[model samples]
Target: MELKPIKTRKIYEEIVERIREFITSGELQPGDRLPSERDMAERLQVSRASVREAFSALEMLGLLEIRTGEGTYIRQVNIESVMSSLTWVLYMEKDAVLELLEVRKILEVQVAALAAQRANPEDLQNIEEALKQMYQDLQKVRLGEHADERFHFAIAQATHNKILIHLMSALSDTMERTLKVSRSKLYEGKDMPERLYKEHALIYEAIRQQEPSEASERMFAHLAGVEASYLV
Candidate 1:
């Protein structure tokens, strides 16, 4: 009975809140395979990727079970576990947040260059797949944060360095959190998403052409934009 319309820039977070309301109200009972992503997105007037991201985050928090090919279902509640995760995220400081971005820049810039130089056909395909998803989401006016993460992760994987891969995997959650925080600011302008997509395309083209320097430069420029939007 407490549900309200979502009117926030943080679309995925709002979707999560709404779904959580459904589950808590027993409207979506345990073992219920929730609506398809397309259906929920249409009903909520959000994008499918936003709904996907919301479900992904809920799965991480153990509140939902997403069975591949079947559907998403409400998991048994674990109040303490959920609260602990929320508390840990709430405890992060601004300085610590910036430090996370700093570390990402240090690693990902080199990763992009290396990927341009060393990526095999399969690696290129994965990166392109992420890029394709991003483009599709953007066309629908979705933020595509999850696809952005996938694009970066593809670059990291292309490095073929286990240590770097492990590092990126460990930092994924923090990176995702930072992206969510900054997306609204970055996309405040009407044309920002189109510009962002073009930037990403330039980076992808550089990598495709095996131009390491161009890849690094494009990656740096993209991250610089993120920094300016987020920190300034």
Candidate 2:
């Protein structure tokens, strides 16, 4: 008896599983061309759109690569090859953005703590320069948005954690959104910039002294203030 058409059988998930099985069964080896849309639709008895969507989803995960003007083909599995797309997904989702910020806050608190314990003359000078930029930008009330990102990234560098850098980069887009929302809501209040300057300075002092715990506390306080201002 002919198998029921995949389209009428059940959910897209069943389709996804069947496709995955086909790949693993060696019927669709890496670099092998997939059937054309018309052919696939006839074989599976599914609409062309569903096939296209499943193909797109697989391609997005870095499992399959689609060449424009060319047919779809199976792709070789490689972890290094997929990092950029995976990282992008981390920022593209709004809820992921909020979760990333929460993760960043926890990491930043620890970063400040570490910087406080290990910062040298150069680290202190670097952080101070960032502070100066924030200060100057605030006095002008223009909010140098690019400088703002640089300022926080500089602090992350001071932490000397390469892993943290990767994680933060994944969430950078989300952070930018929070910054815009916060500014739109509170810039008119005018007190935010000056207060943030003082907070940054206090955190810097703790780091300059190599006092990890104090630095962490100051960072938590600063982020808490930002959260209350924007989220509450």
TM-score to native of every candidate shown: 0.58, 0.66
Candidate 1 stretches greater than 4 Å from native: 1-94
Residue lDDT tens for model 2, 41-157? 677788777778777777776667888889988898665324444464554455654566577688789878877766667777888888888888887886655555665676777
Query: What's the distance in Å from true for residue 17, model 1?
Result: 33
lDDT of 1 by residue, 1-232 (tens): 3434456788997887777778777888778878899988777778889889999988877778999899998888765435534533443444577777777777788889999998999999999999999899888988777787898899889989876776676567665665565666676657877888788889889999999999999999998887776877
Candidate closest to the true structure, highest lDDT: 1
Error of 1 at 156 (Å): 0.7
Quantify all predictions' global Cα lDDT against the true fold.
Answer: 0.79, 0.70
Error of 2 at 93 (Å): 2.8
Question: Positional deviation of 213 in candidate 1, in angstroms?
Answer: 1.0
Candidate 2 stretches with Cα past 4 Å from truth are 1-87, 95-98, 120-122
lDDT (0-100) at residue 84 of candidate 1? 37
Quick one: how many clashes does candidate 1 have? 0
